[model samples]
Target: MGVWHRSLSRFFSPDEPHAAEPQVDQESNLHLEKPISEPLLKAISTNDLPTLRALLETQDRQLFSQIAQNGTPEAAAYLLSRHTVPEDYSQYIGSADPILHPTQYLIRESARYGNAPLFRYLLTQYPAIFSSQRWNNESILLSAMQGGVGIWRVILDYYPAWKDAEFAGHHGCVLEFLVDRDKKELIEFLLQEGLDTDRAGDPVLELARRRGAGKEVLDLIRKYGG
Candidate 1:
């Protein structure tokens, strides 16, 4: 913890011309670089839930929104659930710029970890988050593929358009993602959804074959004659 504080102090040093004005601790006459905010950020980053809860009791609710910027999926879930509706923090909810907003990071992390509850909560609370895309126009569905099949299904159920969405990668759509990852259930799910794999010159099947997909996957592809 000492190392973390020291490292952060360097960036928030009073000498840094662009640093935000530091707050002074009345009793100790200590110049806190960012006052109570720094500790809250550190606690969230370190996953110190006890410390985070204690700080929250006294800190501003606005700081809770900042957790989405870099906090872990677990931390995001805890903070969001503990706080009331964050209507005041809407400005930082989601952004399309390369610089990731908290909501965008939360979405990506939730999908990456297959945290369906958190993903659902955030989606329900702030549907606008989906309107923004991450790097290379990556959608929440693309990120969810990295997690487990349950999360993938949840996202698909909530946002059907994701099945047809193309991410910035070799895999074009959900079908290709399931094939590449050898997710048989997801593949079957897409098949049931009437995904036409019979296109005469579909590149995904060829790509799947070249990538050494399992026989089951190849057979599924064959069934559709892709």
Candidate 2:
């Protein structure tokens, strides 16, 4: 994972109990003073690329910041097309405490929506941000797990070290998160990826049982000798 791989494109705070997740709504509150036109909001929410392009042509710097905060892969792709992402692209969006970088905001949004292409595109555009030590935290990977097995697989494919990364507080590992959420497919995937079920904090089978997981999940965990 150096500065530029030939496969180029193929690439928070533990305060509140749910701090491991991005407080999207709460964080958005910090940006209330920033003026974003309604049409831009609608285009971002509806993923109307043409409208976004038309609007972005003239808006000030705040435009990209707002897009980074709310837009998806479509908007990201388009924005990246116009601007050469700076090395310090991990910029602060709000001028308040507990501020999160726009890059983090975008990554969380990409993970939440399972937008692997957007994730990869951003990785290629800003390898410095993606490979930075500060960004490789547990909560970010937890967000990817929350996205589902598809994005989880994409993430691990790029950052293999996170295959067994531990999550802080509850849901110690991806295995535990999948079990708690009764994500059968992801459980099977992680088990096959060599996650030791018994070593993933608690006994996988028991945790699944306690979480009222279905027989399929239980059986999969047991098959891996959980």
Top lDDT prediction, candidate number: 2
* lDDT score, candidate 2, position 144: 71
Provide TM-scores for the models: 0.52, 0.56
Write one digit per residue (lDDT tens) for candidate 1, span 71-172: 334455554554454433234332422122445556666666666666676777677666543332355566676766666667667776666666555536
Candidate 2 C-alpha lDDT tens digits along 170-194: 5367676777777777778878888
RMSD of 1: 13.2
Candidate 2: where is the Cα deviation over 4 Å?
1-100, 130-136, 169-171
- Candidate No. with top TM-score: 2
Which residue pairs in candidate 1 have backbone atoms (N, alpha carbon, C) closer than 3 angstroms, thus clashing?
68-102
Error of 2 at 219 (Å): 0.7
**134 in model 1: Cα distance from truth in Å?**
7.2
**RMSD in Å for all candidates:** 13.2, 14.2
lDDT of 1 at 20: 44
Q: For model 2, what is the alpha-carbon lDDT of residue 124? A: 57
